[model samples]
Target: MRLSAEQISHIRAVIHECDPEARIYLFGSRVDDHKKGGDIDLLIFSKHLTERDKRRIRLRLYDRLGPQRIDIIIARDLSRPFVRLAYAEGVEL
Candidate 1:
């Protein structure tokens, strides 16, 4: 994982604040140590988060992390191929 301890803790704190049952996973380039620069890809499994909640969480993350690309996928409908791939490859945060 390319994320620092502070980054991980902050992220977990932010998410858990909203939904304590939420499960967070780190995927994409950041998961690969050999890989170079890429966006922060996250797949969150949460029963409590609606679309609005997801958006709010994202906005909060951006505010904390600053201007950068962060792709967040809510695991609501797992029928999507990418969602499956992300979950399979992801490392839980």
Candidate 2:
């Protein structure tokens, strides 16, 4: 994965602060070490997190990680095709 240990730690901390039971995954180009210059792709599974909570999480991440592209998918339905793909391909963090 492209993320540093500190980055991962910060991400986990921020997410857990909002939803302690949330599951986090890193997917897309960031998951491939050979890839370059891709945004951080996160697939988060949390039943309690709303759209506002998702926005707050993203903003907090930006505050700590700087102004960069971070694509986040707050997954509630595991049945969605995209969510299924993400979960299958993603690396759990």
Candidate 3:
């Protein structure tokens, strides 16, 4: 995975602080060590959050992770195709 153990812990802490019930997954290129130059792909499943809250969560992540590119997917529904795919292949940190 692209993220370090410390990074994952930091992310989990931030996520829980924002939404205590949230379930998080680290997916996409970051899941494969052999792959290179892929940004961090995250899928967060929580009760609906306002757009502003979503933005804040993302900004918080970026702030901690530095300038590195990362993508956050706020998922209110796990039945979505992409989320299901991520669940199948992604790791839960």
**lDDT leader:** 2
Question: lDDT at 58 for candidate 2?
Answer: 95
lDDT of 2 by residue, 1-93 (tens): 999999999999999999999999999999999989999999999999989998999999999999889889998878899999999999999
Q: Which portions of model 3 show Cα errors greater than 4 Å?
A: none
CA-lDDT, candidates in order: 0.88, 0.94, 0.84
Give lDDT tens digits, candidate 3, residues 20-92.
8888899998899889888888888888665677778788888997877777888788679988898888888
Clash number for candidate 2: 0
Q: State the lDDT of candidate 1 residue by residue for 41-72, as single tens digits.
A: 98999877888887888888898888878888
TM-score of each: 0.91, 0.97, 0.88
Better of 1 and 3 by lDDT: 1
Query: How many clashes in candidate 3?
Result: 0
By descending lDDT, how would the candidates be arranged?
A: 2, 1, 3
**What is candidate 1's TM-score against the reference?**
0.91
Cα displacement (angstroms), candidate 2, residue 19, comes to: 0.1
Give residue 42's error in model 2 in angstroms. Answer: 0.5
- Residue 28: error of model 1 in Å? 0.3
